[model samples]
Target: MGLLSGVLGNASEIEPGKAQADFAQLLIQGERVEKAYQLIRDSFVFTDKRLILTDVQGMTGSKTEYHSIPYRAITHFSIETSGTFDLDAELKIFITGGTHIAKRFNKKLSIYELQTVLATYVLR
Candidate 1:
């Protein structure tokens, strides 16, 4: 997301890691990482069993906040695909514990891929 978007709560995808580096250390046994992205200075990671959000705080990135949400916790989600008049796609998710996450994607991001992940996980 652009600087303006960032301040406005806009987020961009973090380039996925090559070979989908193992996340077993971060995930419960048998869970796997499906995708990863950087949202500003934070990390947005999607896994087979949950979504992991990593936020770095402090001017020097001295603090880190890790949020893990299981698929079962996702109560609702919405997606807006890029269009002729729209330069970016957006996603919003509402989950248990009153948690809400929203992010903006560049026009090049694949809506289908994201849809698949949401459908298979959140809808299961």
Candidate 2:
């Protein structure tokens, strides 16, 4: 009986630890996402360059798709907090010609990858 009680107590502690880890991961991911978005948005040029984008609209989808044709691609970025735990981000981009390149980033990423991606985008 004593061993069973000890095991149950340990198991209960496991749940809180797992939850804490999950929450911590969420925070980290959120920060990464925000940083990536900002990097992309800041790199865009509008007036200095002639950019035209058409058919821009937000679509209803599983991963929050913001689609635009001519795909100017993230000229402006803003992060808004809808709730204590919810974040909303808006982005504007100027699509050059008719080509829109889409890039996807993972939240669980290393610092090296983050730096590389930002550098690549900004330098281009």
Candidate 3:
């Protein structure tokens, strides 16, 4: 991701291997990370079994919170592709019990590919 995008607070893809390693302890026995995106210090990870969101807190960044949502809990999702004027793509995921998660991806990330990934799990 470009510095401009980062400055704008848009997310960019994090390497799968790195994400896997960083969130290893949070994964269950058979779960594996499929993809991950990072916005500043925090990350939202896509795993085979669920979605995991990480929020880094405190000035030292020691405090952290993790939210795990199973694919079965996802009610629906939507992806908005980047336009000529809108350089960022948007993704919105609605879960059971009225929870919503939204993220914006910079031009470096392919939102269609993200849609496919979500479809693979959520549609199953």
Best by TM-score: 3
How many backbone overlaps does candidate 3 show? 0
At residue 71, what lDDT does model 2 achieve?
Answer: 15
Note the Cα lDDT for every prediction shown.
0.76, 0.27, 0.91
Query: Tens digits of per-residue lDDT for model 2 on 51-114?
Result: 2112223453224222322112434322222234322222223344443333222222233433
Clashing pairs in 3: none
Model 3 C-alpha lDDT per residue in residues 60-120, reported as the tens digit of each score? 9999999999999999999998899998899999999998999999977899888988999
lDDT tens string, model 1, 1-124?
5666566454655545531463445767666677676666787888888888888999999898888888899999988898898877888889988878887777767866887888898887
Best-matching candidate per lDDT: 3
| Candidate 3 positional error at 36, Å | 0.6
Candidate 2: misplaced stretches above 4 Å?
Answer: 1-95, 110-124
Candidate 1 overall Cα lDDT vs. reference? 0.76
